[model samples]
Target: MLPPILRLLATPLPLPLVQGMAQASLTHILREHPGLFDRLGTFAARPIAISPTDAPFDFTLVLARRSVRVTRRGATPPAYATRICGPIVLLLALAEGRLDGDAEFFGRHISIEGDMETALALRNAAESIPLDFVRDLAPPWRWAQRPGQAVLGAVRRSLLEREGVPCN
Candidate 1:
């Protein structure tokens, strides 16, 4: 019931406004984390896209020297994109900066296609940060930040037993 309502509400939002906000957030994140661009420079020229299967969301990430924006459409076909095909909980766990990308991939929760190298770089950049990405979210989301870390810790422990040393 709530899902449909949420979608209906979100569907009416102006794309430009949403993109601007997303860009601002990404820019802020980059500014907060120095050396991130140096690592991401390889893929900065090429657009990065994130496609979430849960909704009609296709965010084409535009990363520049001083700005980043999540555009609604990609200017060109991407060699690779992060496919968020799992439950939204997976994303929450990731935002907390705990869930292992290799674990998620082997666990069949997420996938990156086309340019595997860039995807690897993206993962490295994301995990390099010391702070929880969820911290940047509104107050309402703070509770989940801690639990998300816990959930990822549990997954990490289990993965350690099944598969030694999961990637970040």
Candidate 2:
């Protein structure tokens, strides 16, 4: 189970607020890593549905266009070329390259459906980046970035420890 803070922040929040935040997050990430999409090659155009099993919503990732569409669970979602479902913590760890994708997949911690190639391509693209979710996702300001990183890093380390993964 996710921590109460995460549940409280995500579960009852308004959908549009969550979606707008998600979209802005994608934009911020792309701005920080300009080559992220280009690294995906032709697979960048493919739509990938990222479903966080523990979250209240799913994210349809549009890497080519540097956009993300957030949809509430149980709602009709847009068509995607592939779907990847996992716990939100694991998914975030995977995106940050903190966990190996193959190990998780083989261990059944994550499930993938639809196009296998697209999934692989997406995984490769994510692994290629050295992403510090704390620093990357935080506002791009000198003062805020450092404090944000410190707090988020501690939170992430706690989460990973609970998941039995050592935080570097």
Write down the TM-score of every candidate. 0.63, 0.93
Model 1 residue 32 lDDT? 71
| Model 2, span 35-151: residue lDDT tens | 777678889898999998888898998888888998988998889999999988899899888889999999999999999999998888888877778877876788788788888
Top model by lDDT, which number?
Answer: 2
- lDDT per residue (tens digit) for residues 3-99 in model 1: 4554576666787777776677676676677666677766765556665544444565656545444433334433434333443345444544667
Per-residue error (Å), model 2, residue 41: 1.1
Runs of candidate 2 exceeding 4 Å displacement: none
Candidate 1, pairs of clashing residues:
none
Candidates' C-alpha lDDT: 0.57, 0.86
Candidate no. 1 TM-score: 0.63
As for model 2, its CA RMSD to the true structure in angstroms is 1.4
